[model samples]
Target: MVTALIVLYFISAITNSKKIVILSGVVFSFLLYPETFFIICAISLLVKILSTYVIIKDLYIALTVLVLILLKNTFFSTASGYQLVGVSFALFQVCYYIKDNISCGDLISKLSFFPQLYCGPIVKPSSFDRLKKINIKSLALYHLIFAIGLFFKIYVAYVTHKIFLEDNSLLNSVFWLAYMYSDYLSWSLMGIGIAGLAGFKMPMSFRAPFFCRNVSQFYSRWNITVFKWCNDFFKVSGSKKYRKYKAYINIIVSVSVLSLWHGLTFNFLSFGIFNITYFLIQNKIKKYRKILLISQILFYFLVGYTFNGIIPNYIFPTISYKYGILFIVSLVTLFLFDFFFYRKVKKIISISPPLVIAVSLIFVTISFFVRHIDGQFYYAQF
Candidate 1:
């Protein structure tokens, strides 16, 4: 990965041709994801054809994208594992391309940009518009960002995942929540960092979700980009009638699509039901605000972690002092680290270059020594 980044960086510097840079992106994407890339190209071609002759372009494109999502979820995972790499994100981008009425060239670039495409911030057509390539000045900062992501996944999420493998636990539910957030956030931040190095400022995916008051708020903070995409795609501004019921329809549509986007399983469908049901319950009660607040926190975690089977009788078993301390650190790292550093990213990195360098090196060293997991990113499968 490091070698590829360096080569791409130098190649970008050496080439005066935009075509060369885009060609490299194509190769990088196809190399990691041959099967998915083929599908993306096919979709791009379809979008081009759709743009040419379709009279009702927007409606047809929307229907077509939803069908593409359904087909992708049904067929690809069964046929081949590698084909699933970035199908969800690429399909969504295809949706945006058609809606935004961009060229096939733009759609191809968005789909084949491996960093964001792999595990995405799900960028739009203007994501790379008017942007210059190569920002040597921000290279250190991007490196630190990537290192933080590595630490989040390879070290923090890895350590927290031990809670699952073993029975020992101070808080099974808590650590499971930590594990999910860290694992996903790590990929997100790494995507941001690499995308930055590749010269595009990506939107954030996680933003200190612990402060959220409800499941809706939690997800808005947790996967802000996808949440935003859901909202954007479903928005209705047609007539006053469409606008009047927009919020309710948006919530239902976003929640349902977000759930099933992970794949249409009993668990995911149930997750959507659970979310909407909980929303109704929250609306019914206006008092005991503290209790509802706490309940909302528990509700988010329970549905997220325990939806695979019947809910167990959780007793919150205790763990050894060693694991207990690690658990606490994982929570703090996943929840609070962004709150302190991310909002003020430029200021934090600018405070002391040496400190930033030290932190990046520390994470890199720890990643080298950490026992590696043998699987793709937990979110990538969906």
Candidate 2:
């Protein structure tokens, strides 16, 4: 099977066989399907040209090309299953590559790298170069990580399926917010796992987000690579050019674009504006930083609730005893586990490889029994 071959490609790096045949097979998997390959190539070419124009400092040409790509992305949606597959990530990579003046060969290689094309932390040009070598000693650890990542994805899928099946209630909403942390965590672990076996010391896509003390900290901790990309865009967009309103403009544009990058929907737009306003207020009240952390926890919960669409009722109209108790227990447990126990848990896992692998296998086994159907990540649609 092609899947097995790809796995072997990573594992075989210990012998440094060059894996030319395996690499070709992996690339061909993307190309074998005519429709998928066509769409990927078309979008890749458009973004490549868009970046080229930007590098030449031809704003008018770049804007024109960008608009055309947007029209293709927005209007002619059928070609890409209406989801536009890798455009969001590929566009980000285009920006990074152009800014760094990467050559055509390198640009194509980076964009077409199959491992991260589906979902990504948006690898930077410098980081992408790590693909050139193999780290044989870490192979066993990488296998453990991949298993853990598999368990995480399966567990999240199972939990979310059950939670959403419940009747519309405030308690379910609270649970959903706490569970949302798993999104980036699962994807990051998978990416890191594959990167490890491939011999690349990839950067983490997330840090301890739930323990974050404020809105600023949350953004920095969650989806770190994308956050940095947006920050880079903001710095160039107007922050450096306009001294007086540097912070104000950067926050406004960055948040808006960040929301837009997620999707072209009212809910996402509102999510962005809500966070922007919250960040501004927190910034204004910097002296009360301690309170902001507590406030941020509540603010993030509301954002998670609003993230999809309007709820059935405005804030738990009349909570049932069962749901209310569940919410309280779940919220308190989440705070304690993520905030207080995280370090200790990491220490335990680090010192005991057998324990780590055993626990991961147990979770993976549990996942097989409770697995349920689910769609791709919300950001995957973008």
Candidate 3:
């Protein structure tokens, strides 16, 4: 699949034809996941038919979410060993196209841009309009970006994952959350790089979320595209008077639906429950920014149990002194990486030709040495 994407990118780059790039990319993705065709096509058609209705906005949003949930229960629940990557992202794009009312000739092509198909920065249709104006450039910088993501996934996250397996201690809990972020950000950066190579600019999924002053701000930066869609689904997609309801109403619905939409498993249920509680508690502590920020980070760390509990054995596992020192080092590395990423320090350094070449060689060498761990990337299963 990666080979095919590289081929598609270079062909488009050589021909200087983005239309062919976007449309043909969709065809390639369909070959990889044909089940997506019916759902995406159905949503596209529905959005086209319903686009003219103005007063039915609330009902329209409700209908779309209900349709997706129904699809989840009927089709997805019954499938065995099926890889349903990109389903939610594709759904989000069509629904956003409906709500935002953007015009695009090939909805599937816009939704399934190959780089972002599995994991996403979830760009809007309006951005596709700018493709023609973007000066085509080599992907040297983007390759370095991809290497950083690969480093996060294979080295940092994989190293940290083994430690917190069944232990749910508060400290290990936070470390597990760090590992999750490392795992998630790995492919997110990779997708962004690949999308850039494909001549599409995907937005960053996070914006210094870990260093924020509070959980509300933390959430304001994290998985922003999904949250925006969820917010509009519950809040902005309604009439003006309906929009005047309490702000938390949208927060509650947005996270709940997002939670279940992610999965029907206990992992997702707890994910939804934890986030809902986390957001609701935000109101009580708004007055204390610094203290609240610290509290929020700790609370988010506790999500280690919610999102990744193997079993309810809340005992703290003993770590050897060496592993303990290594865990602390990993935590510091995670903090510095997030900080550097937000500040674009890494971006500046990655742009050096020598560094890019060095990263490429190291990436190839690591690729040769490591067993294929792509299957273990957290979101690949989704």
**Top-lDDT candidate index:** 1
- Backbone clash count for every predicted candidate, in the order shown: 0, 0, 0
Return the candidate ranking by TM-score, descending. 1, 3, 2
How accurate locally, in lDDT, is each candidate?
0.67, 0.56, 0.64
**TM-score (all chains, Cα) for each model:** 0.83, 0.72, 0.77
Error of 2 at 18 (Å): 8.3
lDDT of 1 at 228: 80
Question: Candidate 3, residues 1-382: lDDT per residue as tens digits?
Answer: 4444445545543454556767676887788767765666676777777776644565476557656753563356424555565666776666657755555447667777766666665677766663454431235555566667667766677667766663445567776777767777876776665565556667777776787765556666777777776665555445777666556676676667656666677777887788778876766787888767777867875766776544545556576677777677877887887777557745565457565646654674566456345444555445
Question: What is the C-alpha lDDT profile of model 2 across 1-382, one tens digit per residue?
Answer: 1243234334433333324422542464366433444555565566567666644543433344344435544543433566555555665665655546655545655665544544567787666444654433245455455565554445553354345445355544555665555544555565566556555655677766777666777777777877776676545443555776666665675566567665555676688888888888888776786787768757765776556665755345354566555545544654554565436654655576566655654654554455563345434444
lDDT (10s digit) by residue, model 1, range 70-168: 666656653355346777788777766764667777678778776567667778777765347544437667668778877777678877777755643
Q: After superposition, how far is residue 203 of candidate 1 from its true place, in Å?
A: 1.6
Steric clash count of candidate 2? 0
